[model samples]
Target chain A: MSLRQILLVLKREYITRIRSKAFILATLLIPLGMVVFFGIVVGISLWDSDTEQTIGIADRTEVLYPRLQEIASERYQNLSDLAEDSLQALVQGEEIDGFIVLEETHIEGQKDPEYISSGSGGLKLQNTLRTDLREVIRNERLARADVSEDVQKIYESDITLTTTKLTESGEETEDDTGFLTIVGFIMGAIIFGAISGYGGLITRSVIEEKTNRIIEVIASSVKPIELLFGKLAGIGALALTQMTFWIASLLGFAAAAGPLAGIFLSEQMSNMPETAQTAQAPQGIDPEMFSIPAIETSLIIYFAIFFILGYLIYASIFAAIGSAVDSEADTQQYVLPVMVPIFVAYIIMFQTMNNPDGTLSVIGSLIPFCTPIVMITRIAITDVPFWQISLSILLMIGTFLGTMWLSAKIYSVGILSYGKSTNWKELMKWVRQG
Target chain B: MAVIEVKNISKSFGDTRAVDNVSFEIPKGRIFGLLGPNGAGKTTAIRIINHILIADSGTVTINGYPVSSKTQSMIGYMPEERGLYKKMRVGEQLIYLAQLKGLSYEESKKKIRYWLDRFEAAAWFDKKVGELSKGMSQKIQFIATIAHNPDIYIFDEPFSGLDPINSEMLKEIVIELRDNGNTILFSTHRMEQVEQMCDDICLFNNGKAVLNGKLREIKQRYGKNTINIEFEGDDAFLDELQDVRINNRSANYAEIRVLNGQSMQEILKKAMNHAEIYKFERVEPSLTEIFISTVGEDNINPKELS
Candidate 1:
């Protein structure tokens, strides 16, 4: 109950953990790791549309080939010297990626055209022919019907889909569901990793104290509950430190990723062979797409609140598990049960992220153990109701207080009892005794 | 006035009563020995007094206040299962423990430096506890216990891991601490330690204090009926000694108990005809014999107790 004693223990636990090689490595290496992983993903996205090849066409209906050739993806070739059977030979010989045969029946628009491919990563070639062939066939048919050239041009224009979110006050704001889903998934993953990862740290430290027989000396100096709080607070501080490093570096990466990945892509493009360059590079992906969307300040505040409450609830339970066992290996049976809720939260998070207001998502976000992750995802994805947020926070705090008392009881008794393999019945007895 | 008192303290773990109605007091500035064999509830009693475990129905007082956080700061306790923080530096670990016991940062550092110097472990100030040898860590553990300079000291088996030279040094330091008006209480089943150092003693067996009194008064009450002889030729005369029990026999000496009005002079007169009598002295019973006689034969198993 004494603040001074608690602080002393806190100081010891903090200093020792901070100075360890593991903490230093994790703090430094994880950010470095994220940068590498992000760079690789960006590289793959950039390279996906950049494949280059020549497409050959055999037009049996003489008039269609010339007009099709006019819409210049200049990588398309007219196979004028080829016999009908030899067009397949050209594609198979690697002289062309694939060949499309346009017949009088395709021009009549009665049937789908045939495009044969060697199928060696030629799916993009088939998709391009499909779109262009349909456009060419539709224009030919329209011209046969005596439609004007200006009307044909108007029919070929592309259409795009956009969404606008309408507020209760009759204002509208542009919303992208893809962007929101990314935000929700990212926040949910970070929360899950932190709680599951740091809870083990609390358990390990308690086991260290018990195995070394230093628990007796400490138990005499301070109350067991004081020791438990100090331990949780100290290690909780370390977890926060690590989490902050990850958040800052990762968010910084998100902000700067456009330019960084752009530099990586250009360097990669310049390294290609001369023949590949002559074959032509396709239009590039927008570099802006690589950057993460801006996050709201209120969401960060909710995340902070939930992350801390969630950590304390789980960390105290881990501490109790630590006190109950003599070795880390003995913690396996207990850790599995604790991990079940986290995995459940993880599995339910995707459903919650997509439909933030659905019944399943609503229930998932309200459960105390799942609230920290699922509720944060909901906030990231859309505007959550004030009552739901408040109730979730209340439930989280209430669960933490309840778990704190239960864990303190088990920890106090278990730390002092040594050299016995404690079972569930024995642990129940300890809880009652405390 | 007694410095520490435990009144009617009883604790039970499951069906086993670890400490049963144990009542004892440690007088100010005196060495009190808590003597008991293994599993005899000595640790449970020490833990209750230290407030590590609260007794089910009893009161423990330090100075005049009941045992609470206030009194907790007034006592130093080194448990039998004591260990240092193995991964931490010697000085840093000591300072942390001292601060927990209510010393300031500056005061903890100062006391730590003084104790490490006194123990000749100043060079190891920055050395990790895991790097130290067993005896070396025992020295560090001792320093940690006393660095705060509390009014009362309780050390359980403080000499268990030390070499003879270090053990002798520790005995001297304990005596010095007592001389400086700090009450000391230590538990040991080793009777020789109690015989050599204790001003008072309490013997426990099966969760009950079997015998309790000043060590001098207890010895006098047992009466001086044993003779210790140091001689050169003790080949066969020891077996022939009449009306006496022989113990602690060796090539040069033997301890003999006189019983049934047997005379020491008659034994000495008989011994002169056989061997050279270098010295003869009558002494109080050894603590081992007293413990056996006090606890009764059925309860005392010398092999296991020792």
Candidate 2:
């Protein structure tokens, strides 16, 4: 195999593919579009949570009215003067979000207070209303028992558990498992998408060359293995180019997302009441937890290693399938089997992310076909054994090299053959002959 | 000295022998036509010569170099099933194909322009191959085949889809290539084109070379037993003639082959007795008749061969 010829073929494949509109759209526009789409979703959800609901109260007891008003403040409206029919009309007209109907039971807790609305209200609103009502009832009971407000304040004080991890050196570090899980899921999904996308590209290109009959001319000029290697290398470079773009964009987005989220949250804070502002403070994992440290160098390096090997394995199979048949329609027979491993990996991705140490996850991570995706998730969610990672990487490299050799043999013979569809038996025969 | 030499080259695809002990040598600076019925292994032989396929047993050499990638780079091959990338521009495709043949980028570009201009296709440089008519694409394929200036050129069924004008244009270019000391070999079922263009010919039948040699020698060996007659009326005398086979019989003309010690003078006399003979002459057996007679009737049906 001539290096010059291989380089020429590689140059052609890379330049032509990268210049295509589809590659450009997929590599750049799709990611940007996804970010915009997610931003819209997040912004809309924030808007939904920030808007406070106004509740009208019709209390027959007259005792609970002031207490409810004090608890809800500006969000509560007194409707005790309205008749039953008028209250119904107001509810139907949506004059308020919903109205609370309080009935008298001689100040004894005989029945639960009903909060009516057109539909279920937001979880936060329901929780706030329930807690306030429970508190008011408890305080009433507490007064009967002559308990002081200071004791009540002590009972109502919030407690937050700061979970930390103790390292082997006797130092405690903040547990970032939640953040790492999210990072792992994202990385796994990206690797899976890149491999499948680039693998399909290799298949389509091979089919194009075969159907065009240019394969013969090319095969004559260079060794078949050189052609296959050149094609893989060229498209592999394109895949890496797209991956680099995605990673850079992600890092850029990560850097900008903090400030952007700050501005967006501040805007929402200024638009809401002070009480609502406190209720809507960012919850769960801190934004800082999703930092660069979450993506360690080892994970990135292994991710790259597995991604390339995975692509080569699948793309070689795809190319062989491409050569065996005359058209895309004929690809069905071979494509399904090749896709099984990828689909299995994808189906188990979430499982691996959730329980990286589970039996299924461990096995899936070690399997050559699933390692690229599942192993990356495992690495992120938990500390994988070094031997496991190395063994998986080595196995993937071996599998890919073997697959490439076999595919090249099939491809060399298959490209020259036309008209009839070739089956696995024929391909095996070619491999044996080679 | 021969530019390409095939010695007992044989290739088999599974149980079917595509080329059976096929041996032929194309001398330097001559047009060699590989004539055969469909599926008679003409393509397989050409592929082997071009090093697209390896012979199971035997050897093929180009310029005394054993058939390999290196020798392949020196030979221009246009397959019978012609193809070009439809999405690529004409000039770009040519340059790419030329570069693959080992030409440098600048050299490919220069040759591409020269060939495209020679074919009067300068305006089509930027046009996509798919957008061009079939004839136009064929021209591009032809140019791509020769643009690298290889010393040996092989074309399998080169004129299958060409019109008369384009075919003529290609015939001139092929002749010019041979004149420039490039050895040319082409396979075709079109005997007339082979007769007109070829200096020597190999007639393949059933995976074997049934007959082959210089065209003049083969025709001389067959002898001039055929006669060409052009007449206006009374073509019934053609039926009365004994020991003669009539071919391409028309109302005004007929090609008659005499056998069993028959005389052309007697046929001419009989034709003059009934009709006004415009022309009467004895001619050598045509490549078509020679091919038919050599391969025999049973092997001539292309549809059945496949």
Candidate 3:
């Protein structure tokens, strides 16, 4: 097998696929779509947070009116002694977001205070109301008991726990489990999508050549193994190009998201401060989460390695399947067997995310078929043992070589043998003959 | 000197022996024809010669070098199932194929232009192969086959999809290539094409060469034992003929193979008694007849032979 010939085939495969509209659309559209989708989601959440609600309170108890007035800020409207019918009219007219009825029995602590709204209030609003009412009630009780203000202030102080993870060397690191899980999930998805998508490209390319009978002209010139390698390398390059675009776009979005979010928040605040303050603070995903992870270099490098090896192995299998069949429809039987391992790996991905260092994750990471996705997740979540990473890499390369050998053997025979569908027995026969 | 020499090559797939003990020689600067019916292993033999399939046993050498990738580069092969990249422009596909045959990009580009012009397909340079008519693609495929200007060419069923006009055009180009000192070997079930073109012929049946030799010598060996006659009112005399196998019989014409040392005069005497003989002549059997006679009655399909 001449390297020059292989390179020629590779050039053809690469140029044709790269120039295809489908490749261009997919490489650009998928990442753009993901960015647009996330942007809308975040924008909606922020917009919801800026919409402040006006809560009208009907304080039935004359004793509670002063406390309610003191606790109510710009967001609250104290409608003391307002009749129930008028309050209902206000709620119906959309004048007040909701009304709170503080009955006289509230002093006896016999019934819960009622808060009504057309829609459910934001969590932040609910928390703020609960805290203020509790504080006001506590102060009233404290005054009756003749407690000192200093004691009450001490009692009202808030405490928060500072969490840290100790490393193997006893260095305290910020607990980044949530952050790591998110990163691992994103990385795993990228690897999976790249492998299956590019691998499918290899399959369809092979089937196209086979059906068109171009394989005859090609097989006459280059060795079948060379053709297989050329296809794998070509499509692999295309996949890498697409992945680079996606990574760049993702990083670009992450970098710009902070300022973009700030601009959005400031605009909303200026437009409607009352709603903005009362709205629930955006939940969970901070803009800082999009910042480059701590192990970004190593993660990116390992992801590249795993992705290349994974693509080689799977694409080889797909090429072999393509050769053995005449058309895409005939691929169903063979495709399932090849895809089962990948499906298994995908199913184990969630478990790997939860416990990256668990025995299941360790085993999955070592397995050649699952290693690309599972091991990347493991690396993202925790510091995997150096030996484990090395072994996984070694096994991936070794497995790819074996698969290439097997696939080339089958492809050499299957490409020329047309008309009849090939079975496992015939494939095995070809392998043995080779 | 023989440019392609096959020595007892055999290949089998599973329980079926696709090619068995096949041996032939294609001398340089000559057109060789490989002929057989469907499933007759002609394709298998050609593939083995191209190094697309390895022989189970025996050897194949091209210009004294064993059939390897190096030798393959010196050969041009257009398979029975002709194909080109459907989405690629005709010129680009030709250049790509030419390059695959070991031509440099510049060399391929130059040759591609020459061949496209030769086939009168210069206007189709930028047309995708899928957009071309079947006959047009055949021309492009032919050009691709010979664009690298290899020493030897092998085309299987090259004229299968061509119109009669395009077929004659390709035939002329093939002959022109031979005159230019390129050794050509083509496989076809079209007997008339082979008879008109081939200097040497290897007839295959059931994975073996049933007949092999120079075309003239093979025909000469059959001798002038057949008669071609065009006559009118031959309503009953043919039934009176003995030891003769009649073929292509019509109301005004009949081809008769005289066997058992039968005399042409006896057939003539009987024919004149029933009808006026417009023409009668004893002639050597055509390649179609020789093919049928050699492959035997049991194996021959009259429709395929015709």
Candidate 4:
């Protein structure tokens, strides 16, 4: 009830948390480690040479020999002239990635023939040889009857498909849409990770206090609500600190890695479909989109609303669990129920990635339990309706208040308890006692 | 005037009535001891006083004001659980807790420094509480509890974890605080502590007070008709002496409990006729013996009368 008292508690919480090795490591090292990890992954994916792997040619049919010669001269220039014995030896040693022995299979009543590869890894080679051999054979037959390469080009161009997604704000963004869909999955994953990390920290803190029985001294000096709120606020600040540092470092790294990503992306896009190529083009980096101030403000607002609500929703329940049980060992049993909803939210978010405007996505975003994660994704990709956003916020606030009321009842009853395991019936009685 | 007064305080946890009609009054500037064995509801009673747990039925008043948020500022409580934020430095933790008890930063710092120095723990100012011994933590907690200089203090087993030397030091400070006009309600299972530190005592058994009065009065009222004699005499002569039961005998002396209506002079006369009387004195029963006799034998539920 006293502002000075609450501030004193808050100061203690901050001082203690900041001095800990765990908080320091989480705040600083995690972001750097993540950047290094992702950087390595990206680097490996980009620089790996798939083109250097050699495939052995085994054209026993001799029907496809000329076509194999042409492919070897063009796509595969590093081919060595070796006998079948050497080729089989190379295949067994895996010195060659694979070997393609084109065997002509005579199928009764079939218009053409079938070619098979010696190993599964040579399937691509087999396909290429078969198509080329078919063309050469067709040309030979067609010269007797006349067909041209122009007709083949026209046939291949007819089957390409393109798609588009209109953002809720009505701007056409990412016509390919698959990469944009990953946005929801990423948002859900981030939310899950952040909440679990901070919530576990809060639970650990409560367990520490409980095991130490320091709650007694604290309860004497401050109200339960004051203690609970101060704890949530203090650790919540730590979580935000870590999150901010991570975001800032990531943005900085992305900025620095921009040219590298652009060059690689451009090269990659050249091999991709036209839709993917346009999506990757460097367009000013949209300086506004990268503005720390704007993103920071939005994040602050987002966390301010969701963090308090989400944290209290989790923390109050966690505190209740801390009090209800006598030890940390007992806490593991209660964790699953708390975790399931968040897990469900994540699964639902994954499904919504492709159709952000789908019925399931719309409903999931509206639900308070999933709204903190899903709505953030919605906001990141598209402008959400003010009314819908307001409704979700109100729902979260309402749920938080409701949870607090319930958790306080549990805390009041559970804090002094010992030597016995708490069960559902007893918890129900505690809740109803209010 | 009563510094703290509780009337008909009863609390039940589910089906168990932990505290039943426990009423007691603590007058100003005196040490009031709340003595009880384990599971006798001493903790529940203290928690109710602190407003940490509301009594199912009772009225509690501190300095004529009902127990409320405003009244809490005038009260200092040290729970038996020995709570301290272990990760925090001793000085920082004390200062923070003192501030919470309504002291300003300057007042808290000054008081904390004084107490830390008094306890000879000034060297451990920057040491984390978890690094401190149990005695040192207790010292810090004692300072924190009283830093705001509350009119009423409830110290539940404050000396439980302390060594004899630290216990003596704490007892001295407690007496000094009492002299300085602080009303303290002390609770412990150690009856010797109660005898030494308490002005008045209340003994609870089964959520009810079996014995309650000034320590002097209780000891006197519970006194046995006995004489302790140490004489330069033969043990056989003392053993044959009439109208005396030798409770204990050592090399040159014997402690005799004279029967009711037997005069101490008569016992001395018998002793003198036998041998030279080196020492002869009538004795009051010790508080420890009185407490044990009172609670240990009485199966009758100390009536939970309001």
Candidate 5:
């Protein structure tokens, strides 16, 4: 292969895309869009915070109303004195957002009385109401039983879990299972996005040169294999540039708004089921239990290795697919089969986060197409054995070489050909000819 | 010395034979025409010579070396279907193509500027190819083909889309290239264009080179054997002519072939008595007549040519 020709082709590919209007717009606008989106969300919540829900509580039990009023007087009012008809009129006329009538059965019996309303306030208002009423009832019952006020106060306090991993070296490190899952998923998602997004870029590039008939002039100048490598490397470099830009910008933003960034991240991690509720500090537990685990230098190295191999393997497949067809719409059959593995690997990533060393995760990490995402994630969340990591890396190297060779072959012949319906059989024919 | 030599080269696409057992030689500093009708394998042969397609059998050598990237670097090739990256600026695109052909970055930039200035396309340097008109882009494609300053230039149907003014201008530059000792090979079905430019001509029909020789020698072999008759009368020509083939018949014009064997006086006198004759002369066979008649005859009897 002529490295010079490849470099020249690569240079052209890189410069044009870096200067493209789409790249510049996306680079500048995506972060701005995110800021605006989050601002709207935060703004709506802050506005909602000011509008308090006034619930007129018609307490049948004279004992509970006084205790409820003594607690949250702002959200609850005594509707107990009003007639039922008048209470209904108050809710409909918007005098009160909603009202709850406490019947004698509710105070003495086991039932939750419905809060009749015009459906103005949602679940959050109801959730807070439940917590307030429960606290009032619990306090009254405990007080009547002659329990100490200190015991009641201690009962409602936080209890958090602290997990420390005992490494083979006998070093105690914070077990960052949940936090590490987020890191792995973020990196994996970047890989997945690069493959699909930059893969389309490569495909569209191939189609552009082919359909425009520029391939003929290029073929005469350089070998098709050179063109193939040049294109992959060029676009791959561009993808890395875009990814790094986004990540650096994200880090800067996080540093500038440290506390808010923490809240946003924890909010994202809410679904991961962290042991401690971050909104409140634990009474006596170590705060490090909620700390984000440091992404180690070795883990970053593994990420780089898997990410590069994964990008090459999938990018070559995309290039081959692009060469085989004359237009983007004609790429359906080839694109679908290639996407299935990535989609499957992504679905299994969530499962891997929860159970990193599960059989499915191990098997997925061994398979060529799914390996990069699953293995990196598994390594992040838990300790993956040396042999498995080694085997995974070796398998990835083999797949990348094979994919590069195969795609080059298909690409060389397919670009010169035009206006034939390309199928699996036709593709194979091209491979043989190539 | 021969700049290019193809010996018994043949290529096939599945069941279809695109080029079959074709061979020719192009000496340095000469203009050669690869002449053929549509679908006659000229493009396939041109591609094979450029190493864009490898022949199924036989050899193609450029300057005594087998066609490879090294030799490809010495050749500037423009394919029949001209195209450039629509989104790329003219200057950068030319530099990119030049670099691909093994020119260094500095050399490419220098040459690109010179060629753009030469073509009067310096203003188009910053313009994307998509913004240029068809004829203007054709100039850009030409500049790209030649800017690298390779040893040999191959242009397929280079004169097809050009207007007469630009066509004449391109012809002047081509002749200049020839005078500077660069081998030029271009293919065209337009015999008229090749007539003024080619030192030698190879005529292709159905993937076979049926005629190959020096341009003058090929025309000379057919001899001065046609009478051009342009008349203004509707009166029918007397049907007393014999042993002479008539062609290019029209209401006011006809090419009567005396064709070296027949006497022209009888046919001239016959036309003279029948209608008002404006012009008549014994003319040597034009390349168009020779090509048509030769191809027509080749189609029927299929003579072996070397």
Candidate 6:
């Protein structure tokens, strides 16, 4: 129980892991890999923009030629006035994405206009040109009919809607679009999942040591609690260091190449014109309003606390199971029940993303078993009650402590057992025997 | 002074009694052998001593106190099954284990370095336990077991994977530890090793100590009636000897096993009358022979013993 003994184990474990090539490689490569993967995707999408298609346009009216040329040059290369036979050949050829034919005839109130396009390729391009030409003809006819251009300009203006929320304090606030919150929920979910995944790795390590009988030698020198805490602290330190490295590398990459990503996004935004400001507000989510959702801190603390306690709880159980059995293959029977809570937490986290205040999310967050992950996601999207957060933390702590107490009992009994299959029933008996 | 005392300890696995009323005392400054074949509850008893497993009944005392944390700190146990983290560096692992046994880091470092050097494993300081050969790993393990200078040492089959040279090396270390006033428990199936190293032993059979006593005393009690008479004895002089079983006879010498009550002096006198005697001396039974005779004739279930 001595801190010195615990630190000795912790120091040994940390040094070994920090020096391991797998750990070092994983720490550096994960962030780099993510950056490279995203970079390549963005690069390919941007590169696709450079290769413009050659389209043929046949204008029989010549009156529609000006508008056609303007739209064609704006979107693609225009090869106007090709012979009918050449147009047919180009439409059927691989050199162009498509061809368009425009025809017009002067009439009293009905000038029948026909637009022909290739059956395959550049449908949006052809559609854009056709719409522009129709607008040009409409305007020309409107002037002929003595209608003013000012009224037409007013008719063509765009409108947008804004949403507001009535708060509990009788104050009005811009209803933060669920988009950033959704993204936040996703981020929290991912972080939770990633941490749990690695924390599960720590559990496996505990089981491995117990199953391999190395814990016997280790426990001989240090107390079981010391060994348990040392491993958690050691692996926790490693995980934290790697997480810091990953985050720093990501920030560094963003710092170095952020403008490039911004430029590409802005260009894409200009082309669409609709979603231009959507990506902006999200990028600029006010730090004051977007102060890491209180739930994140709670989640991080809860996750840290629960991760160690939960891992110790589960890992202690796992270690006991490992000691009772002869090999890792036999560990699955015990692990399945342990993994159920993690799986439940994952499901609750995902479902609560869209409806953080919903009954299911609220209940899930309160459930001691699901709160570690579910509450974190809930905290990201909506303001969780202080009471609820405190309660969940307390419950999680209690569960962790109870599990650890229960599992340590089994571990002390089971570590020397071998060459036998150990199930829950036998484990219960062993616990009872104690 | 006794270093360890086990009084009427019993342990069971399910319905099978692994150790039934097992009791033995390990005196300080001697190699006390725990002799039994595989599955004879020798390992189970050792585990109880190390506090790795609890006994179902009875008590164990070490150094005038009940075996507890304090006793554990003074004890070093090398389990029959090797228990070392394979991925840990040899030197770091030894120091860590030593520190756990209550050595200061500085002391552990110095002791570990010295022991590793003695075992010729100084080069293995940076190498992981997994990277060492079985024998080398065993040496590192032995170093770890003894690095903290525990007053009581327990080694179970420590020579299993060691070659003759390393085996001899370990035996020397065991002897040295004893000479330094450390109580040592040596458990093995090798009777020759027991004969060479142990001052006292308890041979277990069917979860019970079938034979227990000082080694020299046990050998003496098995009798020294075997006389090797190297002489030109008349053929009729052999017949005159009472209750004598001939062990071997040469052209110039004869060896005979006489009954317990029969005197060797009479046989010497009887042989002298018939021929000139060159040599006549009683021979004692080896530990190996005694062990086989004691357990072999006990009518215990061999399956359970194994």
Clashing pairs in 2: none
True contacts kept of each: 0.83, 0.74, 0.80, 0.76, 0.80, 0.43
Model 4: runs farther than 4 Å from truth?
Answer: A43-55, A60-145, A156-179, A259-304, A378-388, A418-425, A432-434, B226-282, B292-306
> iRMS of each prediction in angstroms?
0.8, 1.1, 0.7, 1.3, 0.7, 1.8
Query: Candidate 6 chain A — worst ten consecutive residues by lDDT sum?
Result: A285-294
lDDT of 4 by residue, B1-306 (tens): 898998999988788888999888999999999987767788888888888888889899989988876677788888877778778888888888777777788898898888778777899899988887877777787787887788888888887777887788778878988999999998887666677778998988778877888888887785766667787856567666676556446877666655556777766777788778778787866554455557653553322211
Report model 3's TM-score to 2 decimal places: 0.83
Model 6 per-residue lDDT tens digits across residues B224-301: 757777886565788777776664456777767676578888888888898889888878865555665687635544
Could you arrange the candidates by lDDT from highest to lowest?
1, 3, 5, 2, 4, 6
Report, to 2 decimal places, the DockQ of model 3.
0.77
Residue-level lDDT of model 2, residues B8-70, one tens digit each, is 988888889989998888899999999877888999998888888889999998999999888
- Name the regions of candidate 6 deviating beyond 4 angstroms: A40-183, A207-213, A248-330, A418-426, B224-306
Q: Model 1 off-target regions past 4 Å?
A: A44-157, A168-170, A249-292, B225-283, B300-303
lDDT for each residue of candidate 1 in A1-434, tens digit (9 for 90 to 100): 99888787888888898989988998998767877999999999799767766777777888778877787457578886678679888877888877777789988867777667687445666666677787788888888989877887788788998888786698987776678788788888888988888888888888988889999988878999999999988888888787787778777777788778876775677678856754665433356666666677887888889889889889988999999999999999899999998889888898887688998889989999999889999988887899999999999999999999999999989999887657788899889888
Query: Candidate 1: DockQ?
Result: 0.66
Backbone N/Cα/C clashes per model: 0, 0, 4, 1, 0, 0
Better of 1 and 4 by lDDT: 1
The DockQ of each candidate is 0.66, 0.70, 0.77, 0.66, 0.77, 0.42
lDDT of 6 by residue, A1-434 (tens): 58987798788778988998988887778767877997999999899867765656566665555655665564434455577667667666765656556554531335544434455446665556557666666655565677677887875678998878675699997666465466446555555555556655655676667655576676566666677667767776776677667655655654556555566655665565456557555453232442322233554564455444444444445555555565667767776776787688778777788788889989988877677677767765677898998888788677768876776677666665655767778788777754
Which parts of model 2 have CA positions greater than 4 angstroms off? A47-161, A165-171, A256-294, A420-426, B89-92, B116-136, B234-244, B261-276, B302-306
Name the better of 4 and 6 by DockQ. Answer: 4
After superposing candidate 3, which stretches have Cα over 4 Å from the reference? A39-162, A165-175, A257-295, B234-240, B301-304
Error of 6 at A158 (Å): 4.1
Which prediction has more favorable lDDT, 2 or 4?
2
Model with the higher lDDT, candidate 2 or 3:
3
lDDT: which is higher, 3 or 4?
3
Report the Cα lDDT for residue B92, model 6: 80
Give the per-residue lDDT digits (tens) of candidate 4, residues A264-315.
Answer: 6556667777675567653423333432222325644764576556666777
